[model samples]
Target: MKLAYFYRNLNQGGIQKMIVNAANYFVEQGNDVSVVLMIPGGEYVSLLDPRIKLIYFRSLKKSRLFFSFSDILKREKFDVLFTATPSLNTFTVIGRLMARVKTKIVISERNNTVVFFKNSALTLSKLTFLSIPLLYRFADAIVAVSKGLGQSLQKVALIPANKIHVIYNPAWSPELEKQAGLPVQHEWLNDDTVPVLITVGRLVDAKNHALLIDAIALLSKKREVRLIIIGEGPLREKLQSQINSLNLQDCISLEGFKLNPVSWMSKANLFVLSSDYEGFGNVLVEALAAGLTIVSTDCDYGPAEILEDRYGFLVPIGQVNALSEQINYALDHPIDRDLLISRAREFSVNQIMQHYQSLFSTLIS
Candidate 1:
């Protein structure tokens, strides 16, 4: 089978990592795989498999992106292709129609479509939301990263229920485990004597990182602990301000994006997710895979599904008080690391690749 995957870039993001991993896995299975990028050059570009073909559509002008992808697909003639992101899905749908590409197009939804629209600042997202029901219905299949996310997209985007499929994100691999064992030269994480709480994601508004900072302050009142945020974004200055105002400058470290966060995860006492919404929380799975205890907000879509049945603790989103309490509880009572890791294996590369293999096999046949 010839498979093509599309995304905006290979930026330091979970979705990009997942695409790279899946592409690598499929190619190893003897399928012809090509990864298409709208714009090239990102932290994760080096992570792509050497066996898989990579194509980049450089944009001298942003308006031409739609036709650029269409032109590529028309020529490649893949058996099936996958795309995620709302605006790009809209583009992919129209591109397939205009290009008359024979490939079965599968578009994945990566956020709570309704909650995402509620927090959206982009006009592109609004336009894409309007096109979801209309354009997405034309795709071979629509994948949501979680069950709640799928239902939300179906109801809010007016996409037919039958058209939506739930596919949880896969966790890390042996390569990640080896990376986890590598040395991390951080002063705060140097010693396990102090409680260390770690969180990984872009420093964005939707991530509700400000709430994490506030929760850290609330947690500090009870005991001594350090906070490590392992991603960078537009809100860094604002988050730094929040940390300074609380005089948490000493305890909280805004460690900007790292190519391999598995090292930090290896040493942390606990992992956290403070997002207001997520299609699925990939970092939580990474933490679990590392055998780290976790306390995450039971946000709109993902965390609860991941933490259910005592696997981990889930607090209400944006509630500093609740988040504070959950963190303290996790610190006080440690979960069985082996069991936590056991749960994470359910979403391992082998398990998830089989899911995609089935989906693609059905679609191409």
Candidate 2:
């Protein structure tokens, strides 16, 4: 099958990572894979599989993407097209028609559509996202990364239940072990005596890192556990201010972005998330794979799905006390390392690839 993935760019986000990972997986399986990006440059361009073709319709602004992308689709004539996010998904529907191609278009809702549109920062975003119900019907299939997200998509996108299916992202790969084995620079990460807690993601309002800071501050009163926050964003100065004001300078260290975060996860005793919303908790799965005990807010779309059964514990979103208590419990009562790794394998690349392959096969057959 000649498969193409349409995305905004090669940016360093969970969706982009999945697109690149899936494209590579398809290529490895002897299918021709092409990554179609609206923009040309991103940090993750280097991470993509060399066997996969990268088609970047560069210098094309929003107003012009439809025309430019349709031209490429007509020429490339991929057997199937996978698009994530509303903007690209909507465009894929238009592009396919404009190109008059026979490609099976699979629209993937990467985030909890309801919560996303509800919390959209701009009026235009909210209005644009509301159009999903109308545009998505043209696609060959609709995918939600989690069952929770699938339900949300059905409700928010106003799509019928039969139109949606759940497919967990390929969060774990065989290569992850090699990446986890990569040497980390931080001394405290591997130090068992430190009792470290780790969280990864951009410092953003949606991530609600401030809540995590507050929870850690609550824990610091009675214990000496440390925190390693990976990734950078605009919230650095604000988060730093909160840490300084709380006199938590010694307990929390914003390590910024580490290319190989699994190395840090490899040593951390616990993984935490205080996000108010999540598309899918990719890092939670990564933490499980790294054998870290997990505690996160029972936030919409992802945390509860990730924490189902005994894999981890989920506290209600924005509840500092509950989050703090769960963190403390995970610290004291450790989950079995083998069990965490085993559960993580449920979302391994091979498993997710099969689900995607099933979709492609169905379309071709």
How many backbone clashes does every candidate have?
A: 0, 0
User: What are the per-residue Cα lDDT tens digits for candidate 1 across 1-365?
Assistant: 99999988889888899998899999999999999988777898888889989898845376887678878988899999999978888888898999987889999988777877767889877887877778887889989999988888878667778877788887657777677788989887888679999999999888999998899898899999999999999999999988999999889999999998978997999998899988788888888888899988888888888889688998888799999988999999989988988888888888888888999999878
Q: Candidate 2 regions off by >4 Å?
A: none
TM-score of each: 0.97, 0.96
Alpha-carbon lDDT of model 1: 0.87
lDDT of 2 by residue, 206-278 (tens): 8899999999999988788999899888899999999999999988999886666888898888999888988
Least accurate stretch of 10 residues (summed lDDT) in model 2? Answer: 111-120
RMSD of 1: 1.3
Global fold similarity of model 1 (TM-score) = 0.97
Model 1: how far is 163 from its true place, Å? 2.4
Which lDDT values do the candidates have, in the order given?
Answer: 0.87, 0.86
